[model samples]
Target: MSARGSVTAGRARSSSRDSILDSAGRLFGERGYSSVTVRDIASAAGVSAALVMKLYGSKEKLFAVAKPTEALLTDLDVPVSELGAALVFCVLMRRERGLREPWAMMPCTIQDTPRPEATRAKTRERYLAGTAGLMKDTTPDLRYASTVVALMTGFGEAVRTLGLFDGWDFDELVAHYAAIVQAQIDACQLAGQD
Candidate 1:
């Protein structure tokens, strides 16, 4: 093929890969990881199941790579002090009616798989890394970081699993939850000073 043809082909491949990942992310968020098949992702992306398997190797690998946590965390774009509100925005307030944040569903995904200790370990490490990054110079103790993560995850899961906050006003719920999260961050900051 000509050089121009090669470039075009590369672009096509990249586009297809992105489409597959996007579709997989959405499907996984909506249906939970175990429930979503590569065929389902392929259908959503308007591609063949074989193509997805060929590109990602397998369903588990695809789920691991297609996790949206890194993107979701980076997109917050706020100071460390306000990270809680940012998280609340991404995981809770920003979703459509039925869509769940992929990261918020990750623990459930990890639970559903057999012998996923390695995956779970990686996820725990990533969670700590990401939280530490958000904590910045706040002297991020892993214990506090884990507690903060649990708080955010608990709130998000409560909203998702039990519709715990659905009846409350959106702004009010976010405010109260963000305040609670902020308190944790504040406590961490105070502890760091000692």
Candidate 2:
């Protein structure tokens, strides 16, 4: 083939790779880090498993670029109540839209190892910082803020598992989790309350 033809072919291959990563990102976010397999991602990307492996090295590597953890972490300028609203809206919508990975839990395979702990710690730090930006200043203490973030993540995962929000619209589900977390925060405010 001529030089021009070869250049065009190379561009096409590059485009295909970008497409593959886009699909993988969506899958990883929706299914969670562990649940999404290389095969699944490749199939979604319309590529072979070997290609996925060759291009990405591994799912974890692919995830690093495709589903960036830092993108979701943010400093909220609003109050805790508003912050909760934004989180429920974002995380749940992400789940519904296949953008937020539903699986953050450490799988049985990694249950005894420190491998998953590091990722979890990063997630925890990022998530809390985002949540804390809102509650940190107002709360008498930031201690419960960690609990609040944990509850939100865990409950959000459960809600996805139970499929309880299937028919319920996004706004409704956001309101629900927001209320639940708000209650927890409020309870924390009570001097004697645990």
TM-score of each: 0.59, 0.47
In candidate 2, stretches whose alpha carbon ends up further than 4 angstroms from where it belongs are: 1-71, 75-77, 102-114, 117-122, 137-141, 185-194
Model 2 has an lDDT value of 0.63
Cα lDDT of model 2 by residue, 7-59, tens digit:
99899879878977887766654445666788888888888889888877887
Model 1 is weakest, by summed lDDT over 10 consecutive residues, at 67-76
| Every candidate's lDDT | 0.73, 0.63
Residue pairs that clash (backbone atoms under 3 angstroms), model 2: 29-100, 29-101
Among all windows of 10 consecutive residues in model 2, the one with the lowest summed lDDT is 68-77
Instruction: Name the lDDT value of residue 158 in candidate 1.
Output: 81
Task: Give me the candidate number with maximum lDDT.
Answer: 1
